[model samples]
Target: MNLELTASNVYKSYNGNQVIRDCSYSFDMCDIYILTGPNGSGKSTFLRICALLENPDRGEIEYSSEQRVLKKDLELRRRITLVLPRVGVFNASVYRNISYGLAIRGIKGGDFREKVNRMIEFVGLRNKKDQNALTLSSGETQRLGIARALIIEPGILFLDEPTTSVDQANTGIIEDIILKMKEEHKTTVVVATHDKDQAKRLGDKVLMMNDGKIIPT
Candidate 1:
């Protein structure tokens, strides 16, 4: 089912310092929204809030469909996923790591194996499917993280600095995978990045963040 995420008057603070200031936005289904800003501009924090991984100090984060709003329960949470800047990997094989998400959800069988294999190949990690995930280079690990997140087929994908540790080649490949998600899967993707060029290349709409507030781009 398609879901829309809306945030209103969001405010977040850590200690005496406020990180987010009255941020408000609506994320539509099947469109790519780029949240661009400098390193400490609260882009990643905003993404976490939108993904419901973090609660805002004062705001409303409503997940609703055209029919009605859904509760902020486990079911709603399962429909979204987030990938951080530094992707944590397991000591297990690439295949195993990619299959972990489905396994935890009690999903296994021929269908599960097929999805795992497809995702491994999708991120250009077919050759390394059997390699240990922890041994993967920075670029490959990032690809693995993307594959892991995509395997679950989250309705809304929040990618925070997906290419930060990746090289130029892998960066292009990751970008292509994201674009393909938009073109083929109709996943609602929100990416946090500091690169304006990348935002231009990938975003259906670009929103700038500064001083913990979203500015129109």
Candidate 2:
């Protein structure tokens, strides 16, 4: 499931305040891309537009694979995922939270349970599998959000400021998970971060955004 995302001359605005202006870039298959910028520089907005959670006022976000452009449909949306800075959680168990995506896709039973357990362990939450998700700490909650995203095994994963709200230790854990995701899953990853060091740590290619445009390398 190799995927390519191309944003051509994309523009977005809110209340006449332009956030992203004439931004364009391509996300190649199986590579980690980092969008680095200061807050209000439109990194989040660009990620949202590319993730299809929001549409651009001008220009298009096109997704394609195997040299053919794919239609913007439910199937395409399912192939990708976006984890925002503030992760939304269900008032359920850790297992339930991680299994939700697969469950909705009609995946269940022993095999499904096994997959969910693996994800729990992957996020270092195996010991808390039965705990209520809303009760977890901020760092653990972030890990759970990532676990939930990974359980679906998306072809493209968009992570927005993954470490912005976590402690140093949890940041390390999340970074490990992302690295392993690249090595094992080969999922194309797009991470938005304001930390220059973090961008260097995770990005195969660092895309710097300032004033709503990509700074060419």
Candidate 3:
């Protein structure tokens, strides 16, 4: 199904200070959108609202297909995943960290093992499958976080500064995986980043924001 997400007249504030000022944008399925801006530009705040991680103070978020609106409920949320700027890992083995989501979702047995193994290899952590997640380097932890999110196969993926702390080598790997996701799973990806080059490489359409407003690109 072709999914569409729309945000209208979105506004958010913190302590009487507005951050996202009447921001509005729409995105369709299977496309990569890069929200690029300097720090405090409200890119991350906008992404968080769209990803349903944070609610907009005054706005409406609508999900639709074939011009029909779908209720924004738990089921809709299940189709979306967000990876924050700071990577969070379980204090467990790499294999366990990768498999935890599947397990919670009632996936088990051979199917579970196969999916977990595939993700570990896909993220280049096959050799560290049994290693503790906390012991992994920053790059490795970020990869693991991506793997964990991707294993669930969300229809929409939100990444906030995914390559912020990653090194040059791992940055390439992360970008590759994101492209692969768009091609194979048709995931709609929304990324908030500060790097213009990275945005050009991954974004089908790039939106520039400054001081809580999107500038014309």
Candidate 4:
């Protein structure tokens, strides 16, 4: 597999408090990595930098592979999607919410319906497809969040605490989808979590972070 993203000498600080310090890492295509650490360890911050959501204080972040190069933030963001835990969906119906990315990317008209419908069913939202998004329960909302992220068909998927505060059934559902992503699409997956069981089950490479640095395993 080719290298998808690389961060060299990365650093971040807020109010003079350093969150990520000289964090350097690289991810390859189709690699699934899990980030684990205690609270305030900057796991999410590192992920944000990789996702282009936050700029590092001092670092070079780049995305390149054999087939293409992501030279701009918008280009990179379009391919690198993030699904945050407890994410708030926009006020819309579930079907509309699932197709929101497609609309934004100018993928509209009758062509989008089949893709959106497939994603809705893939996330097991067939019954709730026409319901209001805000009325769904937390588990259902999480499913919708995952579906929204998948609708873009990102090359690299970053998940922050995906299973946090969710019940076992929902966790299983999310895990199933993730497995399919890895097997079918070969999407590079980076996940931050406190669940050791999940990490063991899903991570091909486990990364342990502490105080803004990754502890070498």
Tens digit of per-residue lDDT, candidate 1, span 1-217: 6689988999998897999999999888899999999989999889899888889999999989886999999988888999888888988999999999899899979999999999998889999999999999888998899899989889899999998868999899999999998887788999999989999999999999999999978
Instruction: Please give the CA lDDT of all the candidate structures.
Output: 0.91, 0.92, 0.88, 0.87
- TM-score for each candidate, following the candidate numbering: 0.97, 0.98, 0.95, 0.95
Instruction: Give the per-residue Cα lDDT of candidate 2 at 101.
Output: 94
- Highest lDDT scorer: 2
Candidate 2 colliding pairs: none
For all candidates, the clash counts are 0, 0, 0, 0
Better of 1 and 4 by lDDT: 1
Model 4 TM-score is: 0.95
**Where is the poorest 10-residue window by lDDT in model 4?**
67-76
TM for candidate 2 is: 0.98
Candidate 4 local distance difference test against the native? 0.87
RMSD of each: 0.9, 0.8, 1.3, 1.6
lDDT of 4 at 122: 89
lDDT of 3 by residue, 34-145 (tens): 9899999999888888878889999888888788898888878877788888878888999999988798789989989999999998889999999999999878888888
Q: Spell out the clash pairs found in candidate 4.
A: none
Q: How far is candidate 4 from the true structure (C-alpha RMSD, Å)?
A: 1.6
